[model samples]
Target: MSVEHDKALAAKGRHIALVIAATMLGWLAMSLFIGPALGLAGRYALLFDFAALAGFIYAAVNIFQLWRMRQDSQR
Candidate 1:
């Protein structure tokens, strides 16, 4: 694979990782701190959890795609 292609893939992987990390941290903060501090409703907290799950799923799909690309390149 070309250097630029490799770099692009690496960048994408980094972006995906950052997104996953941020989503998890935000979810934790909301669940443990912000929600209670603000007296947010249980429904709102569940909504946030679902949003975080969606974000995680998105990251997982992208990571799988990137892995497939790398495998194809190896072939």
Candidate 2:
């Protein structure tokens, strides 16, 4: 592959990593503060917890994808 193509791939990977990290931080903040500050009751709070878990799972997947991209680029 050409230098420009490699550079573009690296740039894209960096952008994806930054966006995913920001999203994960937002979810972390929401789970830690916003969810409880709303004063949700038992079941509602449970639902919110599940939503937070989903967000974490999504972030994990994105992180794995980033790792895979880096590994492939090294090859």
Candidate of highest lDDT: 1
lDDT of 2 by residue, 1-75 (tens): 568767866776676667667666765666667767886565765665577567667757766776776677678
TM-score of 1: 0.94
lDDT of 2: 0.68
What digit string (tens of lDDT, one per residue) describes model 1 on residues 1-75? 999989989998999999999999999999889999999989989989998999999999999999998999899
The C-alpha lDDT values of all candidates are 0.94, 0.68
Best by TM-score: 1
Where does model 2 exceed 4 Å of error?
A: 1-39
How many clashing pairs in candidate 1?
A: 0
Candidate 1: where is the Cα deviation over 4 Å? none
Q: At residue 63, what lDDT does model 1 achieve?
A: 93
